[model samples]
Target: MIDDRILVKNVLAGDMQAFRLLIRQHEKLVAHMIGRLVKKDEEREELCQDVFLRVHEKLGEFSFQSKLSTWIATIAYRYAINHLRKQKIRFADLPDEESFTKHFIEETDPESIVEEGDTDAFVLKLVDELPPQYKTVLTLYHVEGMTYPEICEVTQMPEGTVKNYLFRARNLLKEKVKKYLGKEELL
Candidate 1:
């Protein structure tokens, strides 16, 4: 794990290795947020690069207020949302965030568990189907292992809203996963 203090210090001092290390440590977090928001691969990749470049430029202003990851994720969120707006991206059938069924399936066949290697990818696909806010909350909270306050820092949502989004996203995912596993009838 890269130590935030040292990495930030070295990065500010013009150490190329430290800069690379910072990117290595936080690139996945940026990618997850960017991937969730930006649909086009080429555009996503460009946005990701842009995110790091901005991070590099702004490293000097980083106050030790929250975890470095949270700060980076906030930047990523703004950039992706800005990109989405600039491109005027449109969806024909955007799912309603309020439409998620409360009745999630509780059980699946023991044999239905995904093969070990593919489970993460499978879960991510299900997560990808979530509405943007829910998915961003889930990724920042669960995937990035951030606390509610940290999530709030990145998302600008109230603490209660963060908790609600996390709960609702999980419930939505559970319903979808169980349905995918042929357990829809059991819900």
Candidate 2:
């Protein structure tokens, strides 16, 4: 694994390879964040590329105050959220928070199902049903292995809100699991 500290140093020193190395190291994280936030499937990759491009541009401003992945993830989250907002407006109209709304009806991916078993896949399908705030917190904590403070940094959510969303998201998943197991009585 490439050390982000060293990679950032090399990147700052005008090493293109180090820049690419940084992107390669954090690509999955970027993809996961963009995938959940951006509504349009076709635009996902382009938006991810845009996030990395911005990261490259702002590399010099990185204070190393946080983990490089966390900083990169913050960039990815902002880019995706902005892209989602842009989708709700026309070229003549600039988006504002008031105009932004999440309207995408979450869909379960058939591809998420597996031959061996489907419990894990089903759980993920239910996770997709959560509101973006809930989903974002859940993913940042569970999938990205980020702590509450780290998630707060990435999403600009309060630490309390992060814990609330994580707790709520887990309860929701548990309830869904009960339903899927035909154990409504337990729930």
Candidate 3:
């Protein structure tokens, strides 16, 4: 396998095969990120294409200051945010920060535990319920395992803001998972 940097250099030097190799290597990761952020199947497909297209267009600007994955992730993050902004969804329509916590405290029944076969689907559902910002932070940090500094670079937010976002996102997820498992017995 060619090193990612070599693949990038080859692509930059007009090797179309190198570009294809790069996409094949990272397509799954890109698809997963796009899938989590864009709820609609149709929109997700389109957004995934847009992300790769943007990556190709911007490839010449990549300075190798970060990992290729980090650069691709930044493009994916920006595309997702732009899509959300164009949708004009009100943040208030999303469950508020307090309500998410309250749901954890109020909802709990043994029957509510995520069934073994449904864990992924259930978690995805819960993630879809988060506001755009929290969803972005949660997916990038937890799902992708990017560090806070990487996330800050991807989202163009301060390191402190990235930490706070991750903190709040995890807390919200904990509440969601607790509610899924039954709030009363989670303790």
Q: CA lDDT of each candidate?
A: 0.81, 0.77, 0.76
User: Best by lDDT, which number?
Assistant: 1
Q: Model 3 reaches what TM-score against the true structure?
A: 0.81
Q: Tens digits of per-residue lDDT for model 2 on 1-187? A: 9777789989989999998888889999999898876657779989899999999999999988999999999999888778766776322242342222221222333333533477667567677766677778888888999988899999998899789878877776665555445566644
Give me the runs in candidate 1 sitting further than 4 Å from their true place. 90-118, 182-187
| Displacement of the residue 78 alpha carbon in candidate 2, Å | 0.5
lDDT value for candidate 3?
0.76
Single out the weakest 10-residue window by summed lDDT for candidate 3: 104-113
Ten residues in sequence with the least summed lDDT for candidate 1:
102-111
Residue 144 accuracy (lDDT) in model 3: 81
Error of 2 at 137 (Å): 0.6
After superposing all C-alphas onto the true structure, candidate 1 shows an RMSD in angstroms of 4.7
Q: Candidate 1 clashing pairs?
A: none
Clashing pairs in 2: none
Model 3 lDDT per residue over 1-187, tens place: 7898898889989999998998888787687667766789899889988888888888999999998989998888778777877898543255666776676445533234265556667667666666666777787787788888888888898988778877877776676666556574553
Instruction: Give all candidate RMSDs, comma-separated.
Output: 4.7, 5.9, 3.3
Query: In order, how many clashes per candidate?
Result: 0, 0, 1
